[model samples]
Target: MRTRFPIAICFVFGIFTLLQYFSKHPTLTAMYAEILDWMQIVFVFTLLVGVISIFKIHSAKISRQERDWPYSILTILGIVVMAVLGFGYGTEYGSPFLWIFQNIQVPMQSTMFALIAFFVASAAYRGFRFRNKEAAVLLITAIIVMLGRVPLGHQISDLIPQTAQWIIDNPSTAAKRGILIGIGLGSITTALRVILGIERSYLGGRS
Candidate 1:
């Protein structure tokens, strides 16, 4: 009964949301807006629930003396400290929360992202095997693209940048659009499967 009720709600909401795109009636529009506001409220509560779950899981790890318990302690401390700061001071530019975020969190995030470049370069070098013509073309194209973005490319030749731009403006745009179309189609299919109750994985069971 519990599963069926949720499925029924999902189907009704899904159909209503689909109809909302073509709905211009004042009543329907107002209902849709109200439902969107409700969704925002639900989302906020869901986020809080997630935070509580994280705290519970980490606290359990600490109590059990599990592997890497020290890191879990740090994680919980960071969360508590951040929450306290955010609640104590407004999240304005001069607030403690904003100051810690800008000085500590931002730099940590930047460092992590900067490290990703080297990992990407290493992965690309390993994956760019020149066993065939297609791979060779890809390798050359990547080199050209990389060089074209840098100042050194212009010094080498003006043609390098022009060719790179042309390749990007034409081939890259086409490929990107094709991928986006595929993604949209896949999303629609998944949504339809869920609405029809054929995707029960979300309910912790087989469809």
Candidate 2:
């Protein structure tokens, strides 16, 4: 029942939302605000459910001595450390947990993203060898766009900004419009399915 409740709520609110959007009455406007506030309260409760699910999964994995047990140990230790730092020990900014988050986690996340530039470079190298005209055009355009935003490129060429603007205004806008329409249609279909009770997968499988 708990699992299915969110889906049921989504359908109920989704229909009300669609109506509220088209509504002209002042009473309906107030109703929308009241409903939205209630939705926030429900969402917070759902977030707690999600956190419990996370804890349960990780706890089971640790208990089973899973393949990556050391990582799970580290995860549990990290969560406990952070919670202690934030709630028990109090944040000193110089505390071990805070320091690790800023120095280790932040830098690790940055370095991981920085690693993506290598993959992009490798892709570009292979893409540049393409013999097909359309692929060649794409590769050239990618290179041009990549260079356009840099200070070095500004010194090297003046035509880049114009080309970038043209691509963004023409192709990008059309692509975005197509994507938005598809998203809207997909959302409506999902909402209707939930409302009709045809999509009960969210309620979890048979016990």
For model 2, the local distance difference test gives: 0.80
RMSD versus native structure for model 1: 2.1
lDDT of 2 by residue, 170-193 (tens): 887999999999999999888777
> Which one wins on lDDT?
1
For each candidate, the alpha-carbon lDDT, in order, equals: 0.93, 0.80
Q: For candidate 1, write residues 1-207 as lDDT tens digits.
A: 968988998999999999988979999999899999999999999999999999999999999999999999999999999999999888988999999999999999999999998999899987677979998999999999889999999999999999999889999999999999999999999999999999989999778
* Candidate 2 clashing pairs, residues 3+ apart or interchain: none
- All candidates' TM-scores? 0.87, 0.68
